[model samples]
Target: MQLSCPLPKFDFDVITLGHGSGGLLTHRLLQKGVFDILGNEFLGQQHDGASFHMDGKLAFSTDSFVVHPIFFPGGSIGDLAINGTVNDLAMCGAQPQYLSLSFILEEGLKTDEFSQILADIKTAADKAGVKIVTGDTKVVEKGKGDKLFINTSGIGTVHPGAAIHHQHIRPGDRVIISGNIATHGMAIMSVREGLEFETSIISDTVALNHTVYTLVNRFGKGIKFLRDPTRGGVASVLNEVAELTELGVDLVQSRVPVEEQVEAACEMLGLDPLYVANEGIFLAIVSEDIAAPFLQALKEDELGVNAAEIGVVSVNHPRKVIMESRIGGSRVVSYLTGEQLPRIC
Candidate 1:
């Protein structure tokens, strides 16, 4: 006898506003779409900000977020914009201090929504210990803009005895990740059209100055380079570092932390988590001798409890990133060829 099987049914076929409602729809979008494309340590944990310590110097960084729908689970454009910039500075081993905000507002956007966004900005700044000292606001004629757009620039002071740069990477150095991967991208994708999930996935958007400070305080000059995998996730970051230093980065696939739901979503959607965007996580390359202590210190922090040494620098395969799969095979991890998800910030 032959048995009949039922096919899976989907509730929607395309994107919808409900996807951006910071609920179930949002989680599905991220898990199936964004996380599948870009997954890395900083993007996975779904935390508020990365916290660490630094010596004392000057560091600067900038970022822009154009997430559609503007608002979603756990945060909005206001806080995302601020945290994005602050985290960039922290990736340089700096403590964020000030920021500049610029907005492109749609003419028909509700004043109430704008006010709420402003409140979110203030709240995020207060939590990160940074100030929005200057900003500009512009309104575009209706239909010319997406309800709202944000761009932020941030500046911070680097710890005095700290030195972090891409050139500092050396063979035998260990690669340390702050936490899990694919949370922010999954959070944003969960709100995209058609795709939907049962659980709510929130954006892991937060500053990392404090967390960075902690690492720098404990590790000092043993730390080499720091970068928050945002646009291209860990693959892009590792590739860039490899190209910059003419070194290879060998990563252990099983050692890289990824949430089960996120992994399932990515597999279903044919996405590579290593290429996803992350908002609240970072990577640190430290001397092999200090890698153990650094890993231990990271585990003690709330934001980095899942931290791991996923890889190490290699002298072979210059300017390449190679991943050792769980099945014992190796593959080259290249830079993202195109925009996996535009406006992912």
Candidate 2:
């Protein structure tokens, strides 16, 4: 029964089942596809997990990425898992150290896709200078699970002089965004349905630990609150901060950055950019006196090139978010009542 079937030519761009076989195909995929784009010092070693050193108090955080479609324009779930956890620790002003990854794979999933995701995770961790020290994997029956889901836990050490928390926020503090908003959410939306536009938009997913580290080292206690708006976007994060600190937030429409492509997509879809997810962005509350210097430092970093003072903490209307419209009218930016887009990560 030795019937031979010829291998098909690899003309397709999409993933195939054989890629995850842990064999030659998997190795080649990692070498020519994933690693070639994201090669870094920490990832070049190609160990199960990365190892590094630290010097300060320890901080830990974990997050899971279940963004539908897994693959997006500028990043994938693998990097998302790593960056999300590292950013969580970074929000607390910590230097990310180690990571733990767990994967849930659906039955009949493509091995190539899974291998690519794993390679992405490694590349992301390496770029952030963190290690994936431990991990787990599981299989679920088809239809019961999405193609794949990834959970990542991270630990880092807090710098000696760094101290940031919601409670530290006070009226008159300035709010600065690391960069443009809604790029990640819109990028996902564009790819999910093959929506085309005049210009291309890419996801903003990335690790913010190093940028945060630089800010903390220079600004120290002046940096009051740090938050990465993920699921509910900047509006949700701001509302949370207002509730936590019992302060009101007022953001100017003109100051908040939004890409034209994202704006057009949101308008066409009747979606608001404020409620979209962002990966490579953050919100920083700092003393008004140090705002200029902080903004200067942030602009130096690639991720913070578009950093801007979008709003300020206010004492009036505690626990509320008010936005001054571009037309000079005031409106309340409330929390999302229902999920606008699901599985957006």
Candidate 3:
């Protein structure tokens, strides 16, 4: 849903170097542009840094978004920035509560565009149950920066029963994927290439904290490891796990889930679906006993309807990922060597 707060009246139509000067222009931008849209009690304090209290274990993560074009099929860079950091905390088995948002704007960026981005940020934070507590903004020369770049730092309280670590991974543990892969990368590529297909391939950039918290609450230590395949996709993530634990990952090619249209897009673009980025889904390494229930619970959640048990931890090929084809042949799914897609997040 769109944010209820609309952009306040402004005297400027485009960003300028003066806006970053921390003088009247900067004050006006924050007071009218940002404060009006994302203002909350925490942010209203208006200090250089935000302060808050929390109990028990905490998880902190920060990420920067430099996605080119800044806008795409299902989402823009605004929501992407929020969801990325929120998901980082969620993967650590935490309930996200607050976030710090920062932005670097190019001089020529339109005020309308900036306002829309802030609105989207508010909507995404609300959806993820996180508050934008503090932030900073700076404007650079037109040629010095992209249209806009965002940096988000998030904090959350860890679940009491959570014991997420790679060392807990075992030979019998099953690898589960929360949803379909390759959609987000394809969505960005489609816009970049201006490619049209039978059906639109939209980005899967929704937040996953609620769904992840549910699984962590029920399965606890049964979920040994959790990682979201973002930059290098599933292959790179599984390879990292294999190398970390000196274990093998055996994946069935036929069982890996990909949407028909996305699969077709990959074939057309000569890209492997496993090497494409995914923003919304995650990879979970869980004990064999809870694999079935984990997959079921994931499917019941709104975010994980396409969840699947794609592979298993093994001792056969230590530090290697092997994908068995439907025709009974196997091949190594190695780490992503080069950049398949850049600025994908």
Candidate 4:
């Protein structure tokens, strides 16, 4: 339910040390800023922690967001915190149910900016069908901290029969990417580095839980494995899983989806799109017999329109990843050896 208390106006335009002092100012800041916008039954109780129920096998995950330039093309750190955790649970074959938020704010930061972040957090949680049950807030000395940072913890229930993990991946399982790669990394780089492209390449930041639900519910165990290529990009994920399962993966460089602008940007920056990051896209390794129908269902969703079969698991080069070029040659695609873009979600 919505909060009934009238929001108290802050006397100061920006936050101060008093706001983090655990005094009347602290209560007022949460009441008028955070709780005022995100009030719900569990949060309205105002206890030290929140209580909720769970059934079936449960999945839990937590992550922190320190994305520089808090605001990006398609989303901000606020929504990123919520969606990132939610996607983590989805990749584990679970249905996200609840989330807890914690904020670290810098002294002298604008109160209005924090309020906007809270508003975006609410929008993202609602869209993902999850609740913000509890949270904490703290303030740091001005120069010691960035404008803002967030930490989110999530819990979800695993669907029955949806047994998915990297261990299940084996020879013959087909690899499919939900959409274009490297969009998010490039999107952040363009704005941060002041490189302009003909088209505005926004970050592909979105929730993937719903689409994951559709696949898990329909395919069940046939969906052997699922993963959202985040910080390490698709290449990193493939390399790690290959080493884990001790099976080689052969990817077609041409089959991997890369946007025209993103490819060009990568070329100019002397970067490989395979090593970039993505927030909204995912990879699925499914049984070959089920890959066709699964791809059809995935493409039905807006995010998977450009989805394609990129590769397959092989036993020849165990514990390695090989990429077949569009020119009919093969080469090794190594793990991400270093960071390409820092503070990119």
Candidate 5:
């Protein structure tokens, strides 16, 4: 017999302790709401754990989102959760396939808001061409947990011909930034501090897996390294790469793409855009032979329209990052010692 139970109206529009009780209310939530919205073959199996097949190397990554202000100028936590996890896999030269999500929801969260977040998650997953194969939700006491926190684990298969790892980096490799930097950090700061700019600074929170996939499909192993500069922005990524490869990266201030307003904000706030965070930006270390064609390919995409060859790997200062200022001054670029932006995904 087919199950025909209709969704029942809850007296409270907000979540409560019963939502996590794993009883009638929990079943009602899964059957009536979540299942209908996110059902797929793997999820429909309804097993305690999901099972899937893989042929070659498997790439797995997981990240938790605890950004302040669940909703931001350009994106919500939901989109960040999905895109961030997907980007992690993409950095490994993998094609993201399946995801598992776990929600830590506060007791007082409104059902409507929860539904909106679910909608956002669905949209992001669809755009990335990945499926949410499994998930779990738990409601915490009102004040104990923030409005919501999300943990997403992703699984993908690395492209056969792709050898994207830091070990592959070498001296003379060219460095490229996918697009402009510092937009995401400035966007968050603008909203939190109520600072208005001549133009709105929206977060650069987009999925980069497809673009990476296309690039790898074209260049394969020629792309030496891939990284998404998230927490510590461009400076940290360069420093880490330099240390790992024992090479120096020389960046030109004029070659890097920074939005005009972002530069102004950084100057006004005494913050260096290089140390700021980015959500939708990535850096590639490409061998000299393929750098020209790879750079052109990156510019062809809307997300990478402003792509620029910002720097090149050098042996002058081993394991360091140096920048050439627009005025022709060279200086060491240190990683910001303290937290520039806290709780940023």
Candidate 6:
């Protein structure tokens, strides 16, 4: 949903040190801009911190976004901030409810750009069915910081049926991917490197809480483990699981979903798609019996249309991830050695 609220009039066109001074300028910015746009019952309290009650099991996660070129294809840093934390909680099998949003703005940042970001944040929170309850704003001198940086802390109620852990993952469990990989990272790189494609490769930044909640509620223990491949991508997550469970991860190159454009971009850039970052996809380890239905159910969801059983757990090569090529060869997929893409969400 697009932001319906119009930008309110501001005394200043660009933010300055005074705005972060916590005095009259700060008050005006909050009362007239931030609070006015993000006002909710909890945030309306105007307290240093927000207080709320959550029953039963709870999951909390915090993350910071510093993607270059704050605005990118399909999403901006604003929505990326909200969806990043929300998806992190979802990976823990929780239903995200509220978030605390904070901003580190540069002194010379334009007021209009900031306003647009706030609008995007509000829209993303609404779509994710989450509320921004409380937050803090600080300004750093220009050149000392990026255009803007966002930090978000989220609280969610864990699904009662969730039993996600490495212990539940067995040798025969199937490894599932919610959608395509390397899309988000490629989207950023295309812009930063001045690369062009026949079709725009948009960032797949989205909230997966609702999709995860449905699967966890339906399959219960059938869903062994869940994780979103953000910084290190699918290879990193699978390798980590292998180390913890001491089980082999057997993957089929053809089964792993990858957009043709994204794959081409990766090949041209000398980047490994397995190590590329993905913002809107997840890795799921499920029981052999439930893998089929789980994949079918995920495909039914709009967020998981490209879901696929990309790999499986095995005892053949314990603590290693092996990918079988389409041509019948195999290679061991190991943990990422260094940062593939820095400042990527």
For candidate 2, lDDT tens digit of each residue in 40-96? 565567677776776658898878789987987888888789999999999989998
- Between the candidate structures 4 and 6, which one is better when assessed by lDDT? 6
- TM-score, candidate 5, is 0.94
What TM-score against the true fold does each predicted structure earn? 0.82, 0.85, 0.97, 0.95, 0.94, 0.97
Clashes of 3: 0
In terms of lDDT, the poorest run of 10 residues in model 4 is: 1-10
Better of 1 and 5 by TM-score: 5
Report the Cα RMSD per candidate: 13.0, 6.7, 1.5, 3.0, 4.3, 1.5
Model 2's alpha-carbon lDDT is 0.83
- Model 3 local distance difference test score: 0.92
Q: Over the stretch 296-337, how does candidate 6's per-residue lDDT look in tens digits?
A: 999999999999999999999999999999899999999989
Clashing residue pairs for model 6: none
Question: Which regions in candidate 1 have their CA more than 4 angstroms from the true location?
Answer: 1-56
User: Candidate 4, residues 221-326: lDDT per residue as tens digits?
Assistant: 9998888898989999999889999999999999999999999999998999998989999999999999999999999998899899999999989989999999
Between prediction 2 and prediction 3, the one with superior lDDT is 3
Q: What digit string (tens of lDDT, one per residue) describes model 3 on residues 1-345?
A: 244657555668999999999898998898887888888898888899888889999999999999866888888899899999999999999999989999999999998888888888988999999999999999999999989999999999999999999999999899999999999999888877555455588899989999999999999999999989998999999999999999999999999999999999999988999999999999999999999999999999988899999999999999999999989999999988888788888
lDDT of 5 by residue, 1-345 (tens): 011233233345888878888888877777777777677888888777799888999899999999777777788888899999999999999999999999988999987666667777877899899999998889899999989999999999999989998888888999999999999888878766455455578889989999999999999999999999999999999999988888899999999999998998888888899988899989999999999999999999888999999999998899999999999999999777989788877
* Model 5 residue pairs with clashes: none
The window of 10 residues in a row where model 2 has the poorest summed lDDT is: 1-10
The TM-score that candidate 3 achieves is 0.97
